[model samples]
Target chain A: MGQEHILKSHDNELARLTDEIVRMGEIAIEQLREAMVALQRRDATSAESVIARDVDIDELERVVSEDVVQLALHGPMARDLREILAALRIASAIERVGDYAANVAKRSVALGFTPPPPQARGLGPLAEIAIEMLEQVLQAYRDRDADVAAAVRARDAELDALYTALFRELLTYMAEDPRMISSSIHLLFVAKNIERIGDHATNIAENIWYVVHGEAPRQERTKLDRTSGG
Target chain B: MGQEHILKSHDNELARLTDEIVRMGEIAIEQLREAMVALQRRDATSAESVIARDVDIDELERVVSEDVVQLALHGPMARDLREILAALRIASAIERVGDYAANVAKRSVALGFTPPPPQARGLGPLAEIAIEMLEQVLQAYRDRDADVAAAVRARDAELDALYTALFRELLTYMAEDPRMISSSIHLLFVAKNIERIGDHATNIAENIWYVVHGEAPRQERTKLDRTSGG
Candidate 1:
């Protein structure tokens, strides 16, 4: 093949790789949303399904890695190479997010079998913040919008704050009724899994910024006292 | 330059990258050990230093990325390319391990200021398990030993089991005495952070297996009922 034809084919291949990653990102987001739904409704069947679907995300990550191998073999330019690396990073982050979702799903199954405490009320909103962060960060990847990614990164604190409130509330519940201890501990881990999902979304947003700018953003990541209250 | 000379230079660059990564891994392991010691002694000064040193790990990650870009720009063959990619993956995982250590350190500071609960006894062994995993995984990376890596991966379950035991112990403490509730929760998070550090070490072990085998390990990662009692 001529040089021009080969270059054009590389471009097409990169586009295909991008499409696959975006599809994988969508699946991960669906998994997060579905896990939250399962938790809210205490639906074990739905949570089980979400947990099962993580295999699909894991498979898609393998596919993306294979594509990365193919692209690197073709000797892409520096800009394209960095973009590929960023895609790989983002894919790994999204897969971890899927794992966190499955963790939440597993927690939902556990919660379904047991009686929940009254303080379980705040969990839905805590999960919503995480899901929304996942949504925004995935959108940031699709649009290559660093500003949107920054916005998603900043909003992680909201999840932290909500988690803090839930932490305090759950401790009080456990203290008030010793019988609530086991279930409250389970609920605490579920809250922690959701909070970690938010952290993964921020990781993805940082990858997005890296993809767009070819380096990490200059701002230091905001660190909050996540273990204390939120 | 002759083709042979260029190939040799590439090998040198790759070796340099690998050495840097090993150094970074050593620093991360030290951080984990220091954090655990600080927690055990309730030494706020030592914990503060661990948190402060995470910046060094972050800087090392940036250095690794720059080296990856430089190596990739040279258009090395597929084997060399995959090795470069694995180095990047391992570097990121170690940085995250450092972050987990810093998190443990932060928890140490919190636990130090607060009165301790008696159940805090279990945390020492839990952190020890996590530190052992980190040490073993880094050795796996240095040796490029897939067997060692797989062994490290399997040992994560031990940490999980310890964490589950700790979780139950702390819950019982909180249930019996309301006064122990606050510090118990902090201890709970410290245990969780140590468990997470073990997870990161497993991640690095997987990366090592990938780098050695040129694909993910064939074994499905061992899963245990981590949330329940041992």
Candidate 2:
């Protein structure tokens, strides 16, 4: 093959890989949306569907892993090497995001068995923030814009603050009314799942920054979740 | 350099990579142990130490990533390629294990503010199983023993069952005594951190199986943690 042909094919492969990752991120976001809808509507059937779809994200992750191996064997330059590494790490982060979404769905199913508590209202805002972070980070990754990625990283503290507040609220609610304890516990985990999705989004943001700059992000991540300390 | 000398140097690099991973695993285990002890003693000072030391595992992971990149650039054979992939994944998994240990420590610091609940005793047994699984999986990784790795994988179900039991028990405790609600919630997260550590160990075990067999383990993992479903 001609040298031009080789470079063209490599670029095409890189484009395809990027497309697959973007598609995976979209599906993960869909899963989170469906999960939140399931939670809000108390629809176990929708929750089950969301859980079933998690495998799609996992399968895409496997495909991305194989493509990374192929690209590595082609012996690209250092910049491309960073791209390959970032792709691997970012795919893994997205996979975990899907898992957390499924976890939220699973908790929604459990929550369905009981009367929805007033505090369940708190989850909607939390999921909204997390989903926004996921969307923004995926866009930053696609654009290779470190500035947008940094913005996503900064937004994680907002998610953490919401989570901590919800956590304390659930504890007080459960303590006031023992009947809400079981369902509140499930909500607690659901909130935690969403918070962790935000963390994964932050992870993706950092990977994007690394791919663009060939170094870790300059600023340290500031975590505001104080439930553990409270 | 002679061809034989080049091969010898490649082998040495591989050896160094393996040694670095093993050391990382050891530090992760130590962190878990120290976190557990810190929880049992309700010593925030010791817990603080465990949290501070998590950076060590993160640093080791960065080193492993660079080494993997260097090894990949050397044009490894197919088997060595699998080893490189597995090493990258194993390092990431161990880093997460370290993070969970730190999380456990953070929760312990919070728990120290309250009177020690009886539920705290349950965490010790859970941590023991998680630590054992981590140690066994690291050994399997070092020896490249798929059977041992599979055995470690099987043990995760035990950890899940223990975690589920603890989950139910803590919930019941909180419901019966509203005063224990805050402390029980912290214990819930602590148990979760240990359970997640077990899951990371399973991840490492699967990576070892992949390194040895060049494929994912054939048996589907059975998750026994039904707290989400319950």
Candidate 3:
């Protein structure tokens, strides 16, 4: 093959891989949205559907891995090498995001067993922030916008603060009414799952920065979730 | 350099990467052991120590990534490519295992505030099983022993069952005494963290199988943790 042909094919392969990752990210975001809706509506069927669709994201992640191996066979150097590594890491992070979304859906199903507590509404804002972060990070990845990625990384503290507030609120609610303990416990995990989704989004942001700059971000963001310190 | 020299250097690099990963795994295991002790003894000092040392594992993971990039620059084909990919993945899994260990330690510190519950004793067996799985999986990775890796994968069900039992126990304990709610919630997270460590160990086991076989394990293992099902 001519040199131009080789370069063209490599570009095409890279584009395809990038597209696959974006699609995976989109599916993960959709899953999170559906999970939140299910949680709010007490729709076990929709929640179950979200759970079933998680495998699709997992399969896409597997496809991305294979694409990465194919690209690696070309023996990419320096910048290309960094992009490949970032792609692998980002895909894995997105898969975890999908898993966390599925966990939320699973807990939503579990939440269906009892009367929905008023505190269940608190999860909405947390999920909203996480979903927004996931969307922004995916765009940063697609555009290779390090600045936007950094902005997304900085926004995680917002999610953390919201999660912490809901955690304390739920604890208080559970304490006041012992009967709410079982469902509130499930809500607690669901909230934790959403908080972790924010972390995965941050991970994707950091990977994007690494891909663009060939280095890690200069400083780690301050963690605001003080629940573990209590 | 001659072909033989190149091959020898490659072998040496691979050996170095393997050794580094093993050392990282050992540090993570020790962290978990110390974290569990801190929880049992309510030693916030030891727990803080475990949290501080988590950075060492993160540093080792960064080194592993550099080693992987160097190895990839050599343009290894097929089996060597699979090994490089598996090494990157295994190192990431070990890093997460370390993070979970650190999380367990953090919650142990949080648990120190309240009087130790008798139910705290329940976490011991769960941690024991997870620690054993991690040790066996690391051995399997070092030896390239697919059979041992498969065995470790199978053993995760036992850990899951134990986690479920403990989850119910903690909930019951908290429900019985409202005063214990705060500490029990921390223990719940601690238990969840340990359970996640088991999953990471299983992830390592699966990666070892991939390295040996060049494919995922044929059949997905059955998940035994039914807590999400309510």
Best by DockQ: 2
What is the TM-score (0 to 1) of candidate 3?
0.97
Model 2: CA > 4 A from native: A2-4, B2-4
Q: Number of clashing pairs, model 2?
A: 0
Error of 2 at B21 (Å): 0.9
lDDT of each: 0.81, 0.89, 0.89
What TM-score would each prediction reach against the true structure?
0.92, 0.97, 0.97
Candidate 3's DockQ is 0.64
Model 1, C-alpha of B42: deviation from truth (Å): 1.8
Model 1 TM-score is: 0.92
Q: How do all the candidates rank in terms of TM-score, highest first?
A: 2, 3, 1
lDDT of 3 by residue, B1-230 (tens): 99878888888888888888988899999999999999999999999999999998988898787778667767475577678778888999999989999998899888787788788889999999999999999889889999999999999999999999999999898899888898899989999999999999998998899889978999979798999965
In model 1, what is the error at residue B9, expressed in angstroms? 1.8
Residue A217 in model 2: lDDT: 91
List, residue by residue over B117-138, the lDDT tens digit for candidate 2: 8988898999999999999998
Model 1, residue A189: distance off in Å is 1.7
Off by over 4 Å in 3: A2-5
CA RMSD, predictions in order: 2.4, 1.3, 1.4
